[model samples]
Target chain A: MIENVCLGQYIPGSSILHRLDPRIKILSFVIFMIISFMSGNIFSMSILILSVAVIILLSGVPLKVYFQSTKYILFLIFLSCVFNVFYDYGEAVFKFWVLTVTLESIKNSVIIILRVTSLMFVSSSVMFTTSHSNISFAIETFMKPLSIFKINAQDIATMITISLKFVPIIFEETNKIINAQRSRGADLDNKNIIKKVKSYIPIIFPLFFLSFKRASDLAVAMESRCYNNIIKRTSIREFKISILDISCLIYIIVILIGVVYCEYLMI
Target chain B: MSALDIKNLSYIYNQGTDLEKIAVNNVNLSINDGEIIGIIGHTGSGKSTFAQMLSGTVKPTAGKIFLYGKDIWKDYKNRKEVYFKVGLVFQYPEKQLFAQTVYEDIAFGPKNQGFSEGETEEKVFEALDFVNIDKKLLNRSPFELSGGEKRRVAIAGIFAMNPGVLILDEPTSGLDPISREKIINNILSYHSKKRGAVIFISHFMEETARISDRVAIMDRGKIKMVDTPENVFYDYKSLKSINLDAPQITKIVSNIHSKGYNINKKIVTVEKGTQEILRLLRE
Candidate 1:
């Protein structure tokens, strides 16, 4: 059941998006996220959404996987849409008791849904195309300027890489603990809220203990290998921006311009 | 009726995905009450997956699992009852320990079984005794225990459930020889006392041959053979073809028999092998 979580999971492929440099992918993701949120009207939002769709197609990752990742946040999207529909700023198109549905409110909710979905699809696309180590490498390169301020970019990168690596491992450990408890008659599907919450005690406690134990073991292993965070480490694979990366960046820039023009038109 | 009957049992992992794998495939077996069945397989032979299905922790993709003539998956609402009837001690079960104290950890299963408070305590003590754990450590945190002790405590937690079919996956892996012997003895005593069907999954041929009434060999998600230990180990060549070895005693006796020494090749345990050799020397 935990296998359905696609967040931060990388799918290997030889697609155009996969070939792009990690730094370029990370930069594009941030830019896309910002522009998607800044989108004010349907035209601007549609432009961003169209670009995301194109990116997803180039990613070579199945559309079902992206949908699975967004499924986890569907409730949040629905909640925000409901709140937008009830906001008292617009002229009411219909009234049922205390609830008010307005023309502008409906339009705002549609924009909100589109904005959130496009943001999720863009992030998932980036994650699917870029490996975790590449992400850490990209982050380290990006954070290199902070080294002048006495911050260790390599250490931060290592921390991020380790945590990212543990996401799947922790999921596997939780699955094992859940099966063990279930074999011993844990009613994890109990209908009562209190009982259901209490049933997770077996799963949560063991998972936390196992994770801590694993972390300590990892520390000891690193110490034994003479790993010193103070020493500067060189990466084996150096990031080089290829023609594909530059073109992708140009494409994103064009999409940003189109979205800005649409926003201006809306104003 | 057989205590545990599996018919065409199958399990597929990640079905329909590119990573799809047939973990257990079209297997059939019947384990009688009060019987001990040993399952030996190489890593990824689907032994663990098959054990999980037998305990109803994992539902098979296609097939039926019957616990004493009742289909475990027939009634979804009462499927939880199968957990009480079939207890599974996972590989390296020590990681399953969670409660604050050893007592509480063992009691968790019986309590979940809806046993009364007094019955839960009694069952916990009985489980501790079955696993040969010290009662003085009842109040101590399970995390503070040694590796072997933690493993024992974890097994005791499952034992407290008093399941009719106990499935243990590699229970003695990574343990000292003495602890391994103690665990085997505890399992034997538990089976004798409870008269429940025991399915022991392991990579160790000697221990499996020593305790099992019948041994089942699995290769690539299929059960290659199931027979008495003596008969199973007697055919060492077939076992070797599947990347498995008979117990050392069986191999030695078979080697002696091949040398025209008139020794019995079906010897599986060390004691029986010794007895056969001694008789030959007397002759």
Candidate 2:
């Protein structure tokens, strides 16, 4: 019953992006975030956008799926761009009824929109290429230093992966609950918001009940499988950063340097 | 007059996409009032999809369905009436019970149809009585009921509406044999008492053979054959080719017949086979 959306969807492929170490992918994502926030000029924004496009193309994820991933948030990107336009100080190109469109504002707004889209696509590409377990391992590796500070890194990573896995299960349970209520003639077609909310009681209550039941069953199953946290846990597939992954990281670093320094030169 | 008339009904899942599947293919079927038909098929054989389509839950991509000589989907506005006329009991329906009390859960369908409060209560009581749910359990929370009791309450919820044609999809799955037998008996009593058509969409060949007046054999989205249980089980070879097994007794009778014994291969149920064997021994 769930629509196939690109969000959190891992596309299976043997592309370079897919084979990259999860640590490298995760590290690269942090670098991308820093660059996105630090980008001051259109040049930097264009560099980030182009890099994102190239990585997506190489990741073997269809362009359509990437767009599908960003489709829902396009409205938010547009809103932020419009908000950015109003906050800019520049010569106005168009003005009407407390709304002003300026050349500088339009330029800044374009960069903002592109940056948001780039951020969304960059993260989605990582998700599409890297499986959930790999990302969890990456998170654990990155947070290893925190273990010295007494943080329970293993438990945190296990929790994140479990929550990620349960997202689809919750959706399925919700669908079943909705269908059951609907079959009993639950009137979801009410115009009143209160009435609609009331109608959802049948769905919401059952969903919560069923999910709790599933969670308990899962807890039992995990216990039986000996999923208790250990001091030194070993995974089936070891992640190693290869030359290909390092080279890709180096190329991204080059783009970051260009984005930062070239923007300074332009200013 | 037929209680339900289905003409060339078909449903396609994920149409116009790479993952598209013909869940239900062109199928023409009709059920008479008070008739009981058990549909047996393997997974993905379109049995459940056919039941969903018949109950107006899933719209058919092609052809038409006429309930009591009226096109059920002709106007589209009468969908609620259609739903009421064709009640559907989904598999694992017990998980749907969210009402505080079993009585309220059973009254949900009747109340949804805008029955008067008294009338809803009357129907609920009658349905509870029909399912043999003790009146003392009516006021208790549905959550507190045993698994079999909960399932009976769920079935009672649909029974309160008293649909003209009832459809149950694998109702007795994942239950003990005694519970399964009780549920089957309850279904039979309900079907017989209401004089309403009942369609059992199931994978249990033995259950279907024991209960159904007519059997519909489905495979790969098509209804391959429909006939009396004895007639359908007579040709066990055709059934096996469709990835279906005949009832155990029928197979044993067929095996005996193949062994030079003049046993009737059509004796599907245990009682019938035993009686036939005893008669042959007496001769």
Candidate 3:
């Protein structure tokens, strides 16, 4: 059974990672992603993976949550390995009928798997720790430079965060639609792929229609609240970067330098 | 045989997690054929989950639902068959409407049951008339109908299936008094004519009192009380303990009964209260 892991929802903790300024966390995630892409050697990537594991442990979430977050990307990782396994140019250490296993292909598969894991881990750590309000604040602050190009950064942040907030609601609405259709004798458990896809039509239409209605209702509510584009926005709570955030940033810079050195100057 | 025999029904949400909560627990209830049972509870009291389980939309964690002495989930085929045996009209049923026209929307259930095209059309028209919707509006888009009309059409869709048991969750919610009356009357008429059980769930005490033959009060995951409307309302202290209310009219008559009149405190609807008050005046 495919687990519906609660990966994207905030876990609500007051650990050091959760208390960091939203801007600092966002900046660190960006730098971490770049480091992940640059660290190709086994030693550097191993260090990167260990650092991400430590971050996950420090986020006050259990190890199961880290694995649960990885479950969603497991299929993609498997697919990438399957495709890369056949591209063998190195010495074939083992041979079977139309199947070849080479040391280089094996290494490539390991690196691909590691990259995917690192990508998910670094982001999931931050995502599980940060609240929706903080995320929007971080994105808005990070995109301030885009305002000079005639873009409404705040509105962009609002739209993104609103969509994120509606993700769970959409899942709940879809489940309700599925059950409603099933009660009407709409059989969705057929083994035939075509039949199963066709069975989803009755559910899809109602869900789409309901989402549009909800959107209009939300718009009306926002209008009633006097939300306008022209007004200068104000936040109820402001975040400040503390000493912990500075130390965390310094640690990230050290790892970033190690990754660049390993990629370029390693003997 | 009972229309439904639910034994030791329990449902836990997010089980085994920190967020685990008992949505419904060890609930036992039996429904006779054609009996209208109104389930009343405060929000989060598990009425909806209980109703959903009855319709087989939700699976009970530790219970069995028997329809007419047959376990509905005995096998996959029987479970699929039972899906049609207990029709569920979810809350805000109007939002489930998606067909191009009212005729198509009302025909969806019967058509899914593999009724012949002619039979499906017949049942659809019959259900329309059952709900007091005019056949002239059959071809109109469901989006074009008024809110009350859409609601009726949604219920009529389920009515067309002609299930042995019908469960409607909050059928008259968010409507004007007259529309609410019409919808309730429509459901009552359908229930009376078919002689099928109807499980009505609502937070509105008066609406439940007006329609249901028996009212079941739910509190925190269990059925706190189940009796006739008169008997249930008589236990006002227990009802208040669960943060529920008797019908407004019943409360008024009961208040008068407490103050000094020979008023019948079991009165639920306004019309009944008025008649009782007039009798006291004439005396």
Instruction: Please write out the lDDT profile of model 2 over residues A49-168, one tens digit for every residue.
Output: 779889888898777778876787988889878887876378988787888778898888887787778888889889888888988998898888898888978888888887777876
C-alpha positional error of residue A260 in candidate 1 after TM-score superposition, expressed in Å: 1.1
Reference-based TM-score of each model: 0.97, 0.92, 0.95
The segments of candidate 1 whose C-alpha lies over 4 angstroms from its true place after superposition are A1-3, A265-267
Please give the distance, in angstroms, between residue B217's alpha carbon in candidate 1 and its true position after superposition.
1.0
Candidate 1 collision pairs: none
Tens digits of per-residue lDDT, candidate 1, A1-267, equal 324655788888899999999999999888888789788786887788788889999999878888886786977898879988988767889998898889999988888888888888889888888899999999998999998999998889989999988987898888889998988888899999999999999999999998998999999999999998767788888778899989988998888888888887546
TM-score between model 1 and native: 0.97
Please give the clash total of every predicted structure, in order: 0, 0, 0
User: Model 2: how large is the Cα RMSD against the reference?
Assistant: 2.6
Among the numbered candidates, top DockQ falls to 1
lDDT of 1 at B63: 97
lDDT of 3 at A166: 83
Q: Write the residue-wise lDDT of candidate 3 on A1-267 in tens digits.
A: 013445566778798888888899999999998898888897798889888888887788776777885785777788879878877678998988888889899888888888878888778888888988889999999898998999998998988888878877888888888888889988798899999998888888888988888889998999999988898899998777789999999989999999898889888
- lDDT of candidate model 2 versus the reference: 0.85
Residue runs of model 2 more than 4 Å from their true location after superposition? A1-3, A76-95, A98-109, B61-63, B69-74
